[model samples]
Target: MLPGEFVAFIAALMAVNALGVDLMLPALADIGRQLGVTTANHRQWIITAYMLGFGAGQLVYGPLADRFGRRPILLVTLLGFVAASIFAASSQTFAALLGARVLQGLMSASTRVLAVAIVRDQFSGRQMARTLSVAQMIFFLVPIMAPTLGQLLLVTLGPWRYIFYALACFAAFVLAWSFIRLGETLPVERRRALSLHTLAHAYRLTLTNRFSLGYAVAASMTFGGIIAFVSSAQQIFVDEFGAGDRFTYLFAACAFSMGIASFANSRLVERLGTRLISQAAVLALIALSVAHIAVILSGVETLWSYMAFQALSMTCIGLCGSNFGAMAMEPVGQIAGTASSIQGFITSVGAVIVGSLIGQSYNGTTLPLAIGYLGIGLAVLTVVLVVEQGKLFHARQAA
Candidate 1:
């Protein structure tokens, strides 16, 4: 495949997760009402449950992919994802829906773990970062339009379940494309045999690498903040600010800002290196979070103000996220699948807990989200300092 096509394909696989979450935003109210859910905060369980499962599920896929190779495991996972989506669409109760969502998340874990492993198999260091940045730039498009598309489907199809059915169809399409276009990247010579001992060894190698482990923790904290914002976005915009129908537009704008930042990172990472760019980006996030929290404390909440701050904060996330992943994976290439799995599990599970806390703390204000962002920013900065041995902004020589 061409480089552009390769990036787009990888991005499409990754975007499946974003689609499952973001597309549900416009339909969350509808889903809740239909299922007799009256509690505002409890509605977030729909997203959090999936994230928790997604994180836990990565533990299985990493070892499986390492042993079985990427292509076969991915195909099997996609099939499960489609089945789970169908089950979710047919749910008659909130419990059933959540169960199916968890299953879907479990199956979707392969997309993230394997996609990163595939990229790592082909590229490393700054080039891997650049490829991921470009893929992320494309991946942002799904979030940019998913809300509007969900709203459109709900309006035209006359039910919220169709949103899930649509997701299944999209997964089916991607699965077909994978069958036709994607080949196994992990060769037989490099593949590990399936055994508990082998799995334990790979996990040990991944976890003991101070550089990778520290970044994994840092990335999880940063991801937690973003997930917190995502969980509360609909409430913040529609219920608090009264954006209503315009909520999709505002969400799209924030997503667009991230895409722009990813494009900028792709252009700059090779010359400036991942360490410098990511350090600068994390610091920028800290400053933006502080400013946002001050605005919240001043009692002057408005849609424009919220959007301005959030867009900049998300841009900072885009600038650092892929770079951090690249750096973490650089030293653990021999166990890329397990390393990516561990990384995904940490970030997803951490995000679920932190995000649920912040999301549930919504008291008709944006203070929780602001505080979550700032707290995570500071936490990630500290983690990065330790990872780099108390240094900041210096690029390491690539191995």
Candidate 2:
């Protein structure tokens, strides 16, 4: 395969990672309405349930992938995802739908962690960073059109469940693709022993290693912050700010801007290094969070301001995000799957706490959203500062 073709394949697989998350965005309201979800607040749980499942299940995938290999594990999980998507499509009750969605999220997470592990198996340092950057840059197009696609599917097909049916189709394709094209990245000779003793040690070492945790935390928070926004964005924009379909497009614009940052990082990561660029980007996110807070305090609550500050924060996140994952997994090449699973677990734990808070706190305006952003930004930056050992590294180092 040409380099370009491989990149496309990776990007397509990566896009599947977002399917369970992004495709359901526009349906938040419909699901809530259809299920008679009385509380406007509880509606976000439809999304969060999936996240919680995805995040929690990540731990299992890494261990399995490390022990078994990426191809077989992903093959199993992707099939499970297809079945879960089918269950999600057939559900009428809120509990049933949420349960299926949670399973879908958990299963999809295996795919995601494996994709990262697959990268770690074949590349490291700058090469890994560059590959992940290209993959992420291309894959982000999923979120851009996801909500709009949801809306269109909802409007044209006349049932919100059809959205899951569409997701099932995508999952089926991924299942077939993996079986045909994915060889075992972690060969048996290289596989980690699937023992509780070794697994415990890996978790302990991952949590204790400053460099690994630093990069992992940086990656986690970057993603955690975005999850906060995603959980709240549709309501904040469509209900509070009134952008409707444009909200999806606006969110995509911010994502595309971040894609530009990731692309640029891909080109320079080998030259400058991951540690330097990630530190700088996190600092930028902190500043943007502060700016977002100011917008809320300025006595004006408007859609334009929300979009502006949100875009800024996300751009910084995009810049630093991929490198953090690459760096965290670089040293764990032999156990990349297990390591990637640990990485996902920690990140998801953070997201569940931080993201759940942000999603549940919306009070019919952008103020709560802005405040949440500011708070999370401060917390993440504090983690960075401490992890980086009392100073910020602002150099344009390569990954």
Candidate 3:
């Protein structure tokens, strides 16, 4: 990464993005109540709506970054995101809120996919992974503090709308800072032509890369599974466990445990390599999910106990994220922007499938959650195994 000063800028940029996702958790319940989210399952759209906007717009950003350069593209999207957040905060109905959230998601996706492209534009392979890991570690602090911060806003201001107002101010700060320091990574000579032919070429290259697709699909499945929980967490904890006002702190604690794993993985990934760490972590998550399912079956399940394994499962997710992302970005260094677009599309497709499972089924039991996690875990394990060696346990030996 850069020195502390520039690194903090990147981290702050990333922190603003993190705030977009994690801050909503504290207010999820209140949002449900205020908007007549009458069913436990209905509330998931609060998060789902955002992801729908966020992931779908990434396809546009890839071309934008490649053609226009990253700096101007990023600033424009941040401003759009700020506008959407304002609309979201002012919405008086679920439909309006959902629309605003979708708009916010579309604009904010530039912050995400473009940021990755910026990092990739500067470096590749191990160096890129290390930089991303460092960025992620620093950015991870946002989720840890964000829920607590959101909770404060909800309690003191007596409404969730204030959180959106604050996000607008945060976005303005990031835009000003980004405008000053976020230089264009893609120079004029290096620009990819904005055309269907170029897009097709990028897609062909990305599709043909076995290593890149394997990791992308793995990361997609992993994130899909995790977001199912995120979408359902408010309902599960508040309605099922009566966590209520303390839910944000508890959620933050769980989030901290997850972020901690990424820091640990950062120390090991270079030595172990991206492929090794991700392969191993995927298996570990499968094992943990199997064990957790067994425990639930044996009737020892409760909120406290669930948190233990859940935290561990989330740790697997954290380890997989930075490593798998680096793995996907490893071979596609030539077309990082477009490759990221493809990756975002693939992952978002999985998210819609996975998020819908969590959203549509709200039985007020962990069985649904357990079944989803275990099934997805096993499915990912199978996919990775098949992709690697045509058989399980031969992942490390493949290629």
Candidate 4:
């Protein structure tokens, strides 16, 4: 594929994961009602279940991709995702739906792993970060539009299950696209053996490397805040603020801010360096979260105030995410698939656990989310400090 097409394809692959989550946001309430679920918090399990599976499944895909090459592994996973989506659409019970969602997540895990690995196979250091930011800038459009699309489907189609069908169709299209156009980026000479010893060594290298592990943890903490917001967004908008059908648009605005920030980061990363840019973003996020918490505590918070704080916070997150992921993978280029998998596992599972706490702590207000963001920002700063040995805003020349 050409450079532009390659970036767009990467974005499309990553967007499948976003579509799975965001497309379900507007339908959470409807799904709850149809499935006989009464408690608002209980509905969060729909998203959480998928994340849990997605996280754990990464462990397997990384090693497989390293051994089998990216093309075949990705194609297989896309097929699995389509089947899982169909299974989800056919669910009659809440438990069954959650099961199908977990399966969907497991299949979807390959997208995250392979996208990062494929990028790593071709680029490194700041260039890799720049590429990821550009891809994310494009990928973020899915979140920007998915909830509104979900709402439209619900309004016109009159069922939540159609969302799953829609997802399945999209996955099938992607699968066909990959079959026709996606080429193997990993060379045979670079392929790792699929064995217990090799897997253990690759994972150990990923886990023991200070920059790799620390940045992974830091990214996970920062991402937890994003996940928390996503988990509680429907309730905060529809029930708390009475945004009703307008919630989708409000959510889209926050996503749009992230996309804009991602585009800016893509332009700035090569010059500023990932370490300098991401460290600054972490500090900014902390400060913003502090202000956001104070506003919520003062009882002066409104829909617009929440939106402003969230959009700014997400922009900082957008800056941090691509840079952090690039840094984490930098020292593990030889084992990119394994390293990406480990990081993906950490971020997805850790974020889900953290996010679920904040989501469940909802007391008909935004305090939990505000406080959650502050805690995440602080935690991320702490991790970065230890990892960088108290060095902040230090820029390294691009490789």
Candidate 5:
């Protein structure tokens, strides 16, 4: 594959995960109503369960990918994802749907882990960060478009299950594309043996490295804020702000800002360095969160104001995400698969728990969400400080 194709393929792989979540947003209310769910907050479990499974599943895929190879493991998982999506579409009960979603998420975990591992196989430091940012910029389009697609489907197809079917078809297309075009990134000599001892050593190396673990934790905290917003976005936009059908467009606007920020980061990361850019972004996030909360408290929050603040916050998140992940993986290049798995597990599971708490705390107001963002920003900053030993904005030469 050409450089552009590789980057786009990577983005397409990651976009599968984004589509699974975002495409369901418009159908959340319909699913709840049809499934006899009355509580608004409980509908969040549709997303939380998949994320939990996605996180837990990562622990195994990394080790397996390290032992076998990226290509085989990814192909198998994509097939599983297709089957799981079909199962979800066929669900007759809410529990059955959740079960299928967990299965789907478990299969989807391979995509997230292996995408990072594949990139890590080729790049490091600032280059890796730039590559990831570019890929993420493209991946952001799914979130920007998915809700609108979901709404369109609901308007035309008249059933929530069709979204699952659509997901299955998309995954199948990706699976075919991957099989025909994607090659194994991990070389034979670089592959680890499939042994308990090897797995333990790899995991220990990942965890024992303070830089890797700290950045992973910090990234997880940042992800929690994102998930919190996504899980509650429908309610906040449609129910609280009365945006109605415009919710999808509003959500897309925030996603577009993140996409633009990601593109900017990709272009600037090599010159400015990951540490400087990510640190400044985190600080900006904290300040934005504080101001957003103040506006909420002042009783002056409007849909437009909320959208503007969220767009800015999402931009900060976009800048922080790729850089943080690149830094975490920088120190664990040899164990990229395992390291990616560990970090992916931490980020996904932690985000789900944190996001779920904030989503469940919805009281027909934006205060809880704003407070959650503030807490997340502070927590991320604290973790980064400990990891860097109170250092900030330190530049490193490209590896």
Candidate 6:
């Protein structure tokens, strides 16, 4: 693949995960009703279940990808994802659907882990960060349109299950494309031995690196806020603000704002450096979260008012997330696959646990999410500060 095609392909691969989540947002209520979900908050288990499985599966894929090769592992996982999606679509109960979704998430983990591994196989430092930002900029389109597309599919197809059917079809198409176009990025000479010692050593190397481990934790905390919003977005928009059918469009606008921020980060990271851009974004997020909470507490918040702050907050996350991931991987390039998997596992699993708590705390208002954002922002900043040794906004001289 050419450079542009490579970026688009990676973006598409990562977008599959986004599609799995965002596409379900519009259909959540329908699924709940059909599956006899008893409580309003309990419906969030659909997302939490998948995320938990997604995170747990990452623990193995990195080692397997290192041992086998990116291409074969990805193909197998994609096939599994397709099968699981089909099963999910035919679910007879809430428990059945949740189980299928978890299976699907387990399968989907390979796409995320290998995508990063493949990129790290080529680039490092700010260049890798730049590439990821660009990929994410394109990838944001999935979130921008997914909910709307889900709403459309739900309306026309008249069944929430059709959403999973559509996902399976899309996964199949991507699988074919990847098989045809993506060659093994990790060559034999660079491949790690398939041994427990090798895997354990890689994990130790990754975990022992302060930069890698610290930023991974920081990124997970920051991501917790985003996931919190995602889990509760439909409720906040439809139930609290009465946006109703317009919910997807408003959701898209928030996603679009993140896309814009990602595009800007792509341009600015190389020039301004990831450290500077990310730190600025995090501080901005803290301020935005505080203001957002005040607005909600005053009982004067409107839909647009909530959206504007949410979009700004998501933009901050976009800036911080790419930077944090790249920085975490910077010192662990030799063990890229295992390192990627470990970091991914921590971030995804941690985010899911925390995000779920925040989601379940929802009470017909934005207070939980807003406060969650503030708490997460503070936590992320503290982690970043410790990682940087109290340095703030200082770019590396070469970067």
Distance (Å) between predicted and true CA of 53, model 1? 1.3
Tens digits of per-residue lDDT, candidate 5, 1-399, equal 899999999999999899988999999999999988889988888988899889999998998988888999999999999999999999988899999989999999999999999999989998999999999999999999999999999999989999999999999998998899998899899999989899889889999998889888888888888788899999999999999989999999988988999999999999898888889999999999899999999999998889999999999988889888999999999999999999999989988988898889999998998898888888888998898898887765662
lDDT of 4 by residue, 1-399 (tens): 999999999999999999988898999998999999989899999998999999999989999999999999999999999999999999999999999999999999999999999999999988899999999999999999999999999989988999999999999988998999999999999999999999899989999998899988888887778788888899999999999889999999998999998999999988878887788887888898889889988989999999999999999998899888998999999999988999999988988888888889999998888888888888888898898888787765552
Compute each candidate's TM-score over C-alphas: 0.98, 0.95, 0.94, 0.99, 0.99, 0.98
lDDT of 6 at 382: 91
Clashes of each: 0, 10, 0, 0, 0, 0
How many clashing residue pairs, candidate 2? Answer: 10
| Candidate 2: tens digits of C-alpha lDDT, residues 1-399 | 457866776777777767678787887887888898988888888778888898899989988887877788888888998899999999989999889978988888887788888877778878998999998888877777777788888789988899999988988987887788767767788877889998988887777777677777766666777787888878877888788778778777766777778788888787878777777777677677777777677877577777778777777788778878877776666667777888888787777777788778788877676676667667767877776677776542333
Model 3 whole-model lDDT (C-alpha atoms):
0.78
lDDT of each: 0.89, 0.79, 0.78, 0.91, 0.91, 0.91
Write one digit per residue (lDDT tens) for candidate 1, span 155-240: 89989999999999999999999999998899999998889899888888888998888888887877777778778888999999
Model 6 spans > 4 angstroms off: 397-399
Q: How would the candidate models be sorted by lDDT, starting from the highest?
A: 4, 5, 6, 1, 2, 3
Off by over 4 Å in 5: none
Error of 1 at 32 (Å): 0.7
RMSD to truth, every model: 1.0, 1.9, 2.3, 0.9, 0.9, 1.0
Worst 10 residues of 3 by lDDT: 390-399
- lDDT score of residue 365 within candidate 6: 86
Q: Candidate 3 on 288-359: residue-level lDDT in tens?
A: 888888888898888887788778888888877877777787788788888897887777667767867855
TM-score of 5: 0.99
